[model samples]
Structures are given as structure tokens and as C-alpha cells.
Target: MVVTRFAPSPNGSLHLGHAFSAIAAHDIAQERGGRFLLRIEDIDGERSMPEKAAEFRKDLAWLGLEWEEVPAQSTRLANYEEAAQYLLHEGLLYPCTCTRKDIAARNPRMGPEGAVYPGTCKGQSLDPDKPAALRLDVDRAMAGLGELSWEDEVGGTQIADPRPFGDVVLVRKDAPASYHLAATLDDAADGVTLVTRGEDLFSSTHVHRVLQELLGLPVPTWHHHPILLDEEDEKLAKRRCSPSLADRRAAGEDGRALARQLRMGEFPAGITQSNA
Candidate 1:
């Protein structure tokens, strides 16, 4: 059976961009008579609010989206740890003690997530007791997997090139699992067949594909739909204080109507759509 999921972090309220992504995944699953799942990405111990996850379910339901709820990432820490340990044991991961300042001092080239790591701690013999984040040896991983590619519903077949991301951290010093490791493992564990999200995450998929190969996880097809932008043509993000779906609901706006508008590519005033 085809399976798709809408995984959202509960650090903030759901906004229009979140609605668009959720409706897309929900509709796709409904149309294909497949399963639609909801994953609460509440692994951020510092920022994740338990109450916000409940709000997410309310918002999604108000939007007329139904999904099979999966256990939150917070409840699956051991699974992520096991995956990280496997990668580390296989020599595909290394512990890095580099601070942000240490990376900046290297004058490293910029990638999607700021300065690409210089691999300063790639082969460094460090004390096991010292705190360190685990980073994937992307170069070595690709060399072992050889060339790889993944299919996109709209973009067709695309080659996976994770070199630009450099060695991304799979386990952070502060968190049990980074987004890259947690999401990849969760998708496979949940038996997801299609991954759906905003187009802004397209680059991240390359790194995810590599992780899937290294961890021997099943690869899921992806559908990166357009993102909603504000009047200034900036992508709507929580950090920017975009108006949330809950706020509109509080104002007595009909959520089902909003979902229909999003489905038809019609957005509220001051909001626009962009493939970027």
C-alpha cells in the first residue's frame, strides 16, 4: 500500500505553509486509497512544547485532514541511537568536537546549512568522555554506495549528490538525534512509501538518500511541492512570525474553506506561492 506522511515539529503553531504541505500529503494518500500518517517531530528537548503537538492535531483535523498518528520522535530515542551506533561502528561516522567558532575560524565554504564542515575532526583521536557530535563521513559513504538517485513525483528521476552538504551531524551534542538521522529512520520504520514536504527541503533529500543507503533502509519517493510566500516573496517560516492556522481559527475562520483555497492554489491576501 502507498504510504505518505506529514511530519511537523511542535515547536510552534501550524501556519498556512504547514497547511499546504499537510493537505497535499493527506489528499495524495486519500486519492490513492493509501495510508496518511502524522509524525510529531518533537525531539528538540529545549524548544519542543508538548502542548503544541496537541494543537497540531487540532489544526490538521480542522483543515479536514485525517492521519494515522505515529509515536513522537521523543519516544523513539533508542532506535535513533542504535542507527547512529551502527554508522559509527561501520566507520561511516566520527565524533567531532568542533564548536561554531572553530568552524568559522576555518573560513569554510558555505553550503545549505551555513559553512560546510572542514572535517577538522575526521581522523582526530579524541577522548571518548569528551562531548562531541557524530558526523557522517559523506565522502566515504558515497564511495561505498557508488552513484545513487531517487525519483520525485514532479521532478522525475534526479541524481543524489550529497557532497555539498559535507559531513552532516547525525547526533548533536545536545540532542539524541539530529533531524537528518531521526526523520530518515522514522520514515523507514513507519513503512512510508512517499515523502511529501515543501520544495525548500529538496536539498536535504540528497543527504537523506545517502543515509538510507548507509543504514540499509528502504528508500521512499519524494514529492516536493511549492512553498507559500509572504507579500515580500519570502518563504513563510515560524522564525519570521507568520500568521498561524490557529490564529485564523481563533478569529472564527473556516478551516475547511482554507484547505480548499490551498488546494486550488489560491492563498490568502499577502501570501503567494513559489516553487522555490
Candidate 2:
């Protein structure tokens, strides 16, 4: 059976973009008689709000989307640690002590996630007691995997190349697991057969695919649907203060009607759609 998931971080209220993504995953599963799952990505330490997770559930329920709940990342620290240990044992990971300032000073080229890590600590020998983040040796990993690829429901087969992101962090000093590490593990653990989210995360799939290969996790197909955009053609993001779904609900908007409009490619005023 196909299983899809809508994993959201509870750092803020759910916005239209989030609602659209959830509805997309839910509808896909319902159409196929498959299972749709929900996961709370509250692994950002104090920045993650448990209360917001409750609000996220309320927003999804209000939108008429149903999903089976899964264990949040905060509850799966051991799983992430175990995976990290396995990679460390295999020499596919190294301790990185580079701070954000350290990376910026290197004049590194830009990548999907801000400035690409310059591999400053790639081959450095470090103290075990020093505070550091664990980074995946993407070069060595891809060398071992020997040309990997994944299928996308819309884009079809995509050759995986994670080198552009540099040696991505698997575990950080402040957090138990990075999104790349936790999301990949959680998807496999939940028996997800299809991963669906916005197209902006399309590049992230490369990093996730490499993690899946290194961790010996099950591979699932992906469907990166179009993202909802604002009047300025910017992707609707919580950080930008986009109008939230909770706000719409509070105004007595019809949740089911809004969902139907989204399904028909109709969006509210000032909100547009973009696949780029």
C-alpha cells in the first residue's frame, strides 16, 4: 500500500502553502486508498513550540484532511543517533566545527541551503570532546553509491547529485538531527511509499536520497508539487508573515470550499501558484 506524509515543523501557524501541501498529500493517498500520515518536526529545540503543533493539527482538521499520526522527531533521538553512529563507524561522517561565520568567510558559492559549506573541516582531525556538528562526506558517499537516481511522479526519473550542497550536516551541536537526517529516517520508519511536498524542496531530495543510500533505508518516490506564491511571486513562507490558515479560519472562511478551489487551481486574492 502506498503511504504518504505531510511533515510540518511547529515553529509557527500553518499558512495557505502548508494547507495546499497537506491537502495534496491527503488527496493523493485517498485517491489510491493508501495511508496518509502526519509528523510533527519539532526538533529545533526551544525554537519548536509544542503548542503550535496542536494548532497545526487543528488547522489540518479544519481543512478536512485526515492522517495517521506518527512519532515526532523529538521522540526519536535514539534513532537519529544510531544512524549517525552507523555512518561514523563506516567513515562516511566527520565532526565539523565550522560556525556560520567561518563558512561565510570562505567566500563559498551559494547552494540550496544558504552558503555551501567549504569543506574546511572535511579532513581535519579534531578533539572528540570539542563541540561540533556531524557532516556527511557526500563525495565519499556518492563514490560508494555509484550513480544513484530516484523517480518523481511529475518529473519522472531524476539523477541524484548531492555534491552541490557540500558535506551536509547530519547532526548539529544544538540539535540532535538535521532535517536531512531525520526526515529520511522518519519516512522509512513510517513505511512511506510516496513523499509529497512543494517543488522548492526538490533540491533537498538529492540530499535525502544520499542519506537513504548511506543509512540503508527504504527508497520512496517523490512528488514535488507546485508551491503557493504571494502577490510578489515569492513562495509563501512563515518567516515572511504570509496570511495563515488559522487567520482565514478565524474570519469564517469555508475550509472545504477553499480546499476545493485549490484543487481546481483557484487561489484567493494576492495568492498565486508557482512550480518554480
Candidate 3:
């Protein structure tokens, strides 16, 4: 069965971009008679608002979408810790004590996400007691695993290359797992067969494919659909203070009508979708 998921972080209100993504996943599963799952990514303890998750449920229900709920990331800490331990035991993970400021000062070349970390603590004998983030040794991880690839519904077969990410973090000093590790494990755990998300995350799939292989997790097809953009061509984001679904609902707008219009490529004024 084509099990699809729309995993959203419960840090803020659901915006139109989030609505579009959820609708995409929901419709895909519905069309295939497959299961649709919802996973709340509320691992950021400091920023995560429990009430936002409830609002997300209300938002999805308002949009006429249904999904089976899965355990949130916060509730899956042990799973992430176990995987991180496995990688650490296999010598695939190394502890780094470098702060973001320390990394940025090095003037490192940028990658898909941001400034790639320079190997400052790769071989250093850092104090184990010091708080440190765990980074995956991507070079060593891919040493023998040659010519890896994964399929995408939109882009077809894509060659997996995670070297550019430069020792991506698997565990953070403040959190049990990084998004790369947690999301990969959660997807496998939840039996997600089709990972539907925005196209901006397309490059991150390269790193995710590597994690799935290294951790011996089930590989799933991905469909990175076009993201909804604002009039300025910027992706709608909570950080950007984008208009949220709750706001629309409070204004007496019909969510089903909005969803139907979204399906037909009709967006509100100042909203448009990126090229698929």
C-alpha cells in the first residue's frame, strides 16, 4: 500500500504552504486507497507548543483531510537514541563541540542547507564531558557504498550524493536526534511508502537516502512537489509570519472550497506555486 505522511512541526500555526503539502499527501493516499499518516515533529522542546499540534489537527480536519496519527518525535526519543548509538558504535558518528559561531568564522563553503562545517574537531581529543553535537562521518559512511540512488515520483531516479553536506549532524547537543536521523527513522517506523513534501527539500533526500542505507531502514519513494510561494517568490514560512489557516478559518472562510481551489491550481491573491 502507498502509505504517505505529512509530518509537520508543532512550533507555529499551519500556513497555506503547510495546507497545500498536507492536502497533497492526503489526496495521494486517498487516490491510491492507501493510508495517510500524521506525525508531529515537536522535538524542539524549547520552541514546540503543544497547543499548536492540537491546532494542526483542527486545521487538517477543517481542510477535509483525514489521517492516522503516529507517535510524535518527542515521544520517539528512545528510537532516535538507539539509532544514534548504533551509528556511534559503528564509528560512523563523532562528537563535535564546535558552536555555530565557531563554524561560521571559518568561512566554510556553502552547501544545500547552509555553511558546511569544516572538520575542526574530526580528530581532536575533545572532552567527553563537554556538551557536543554528534556528526555522521559521511566520507566513511559512503566509502564502500558506491553508486547509491533513489526514485522520486516527480524527478524520477536521482543519484545520491551526500558529500556536500559535510558530516551532517545525527544528534544535537540539546536534542536526542537531528531531523536527518529522526525523520528517516520515523518514516521507516511508521511504514511510510511515499514521502510527500516540498521540492525545497529535494536536495536533503540525498542525505536521507544515505541514512536509510547506513541504518538498514526500508527505502521509500519520494515525491517533492512544488512549494507555494508568496508574491515576492519567497516560500511561505512560519518564521516569515505568513498568513495561517487558523486566520482564514476565523474569518469564516470555507476550508473545503479553498482546498478544492488549491486542487485546481487556484491560489489566493499574492500566492502561487513553484514550477513542478
- Backbone clash pairs for candidate 2 read none
Model 3 Cα lDDT, one tens digit per residue, 142-163: 9978999999999999999998
- Can you rank all candidates by TM-score, best first? 3, 1, 2
Expressed as tens digits, the lDDT of each residue in 1-276 for candidate 1 is 889999999888889999999999999999999999999999897899999998998999899888999999999999998998888888889889999999999999999888999999998653679999999889889897878899999889989998998999999999999999999999999999999988889999999999998888999999999999999999999999999989998899999999998999888899989963
What are the runs in model 1 whose C-alpha is more than 4 Å off?
none
- Residue 231: error of model 3 in Å? 1.5
Q: What is the lDDT of candidate 2?
A: 0.91
Misplaced by over 4 Å in model 2 are none
Greater lDDT among 2 and 3 belongs to 3
- Full-model lDDT for every candidate: 0.92, 0.91, 0.92
TM-scores of the candidates are: 0.97, 0.97, 0.98
Which candidate has the top score in TM-score?
3
lDDT of 2 at 209: 91
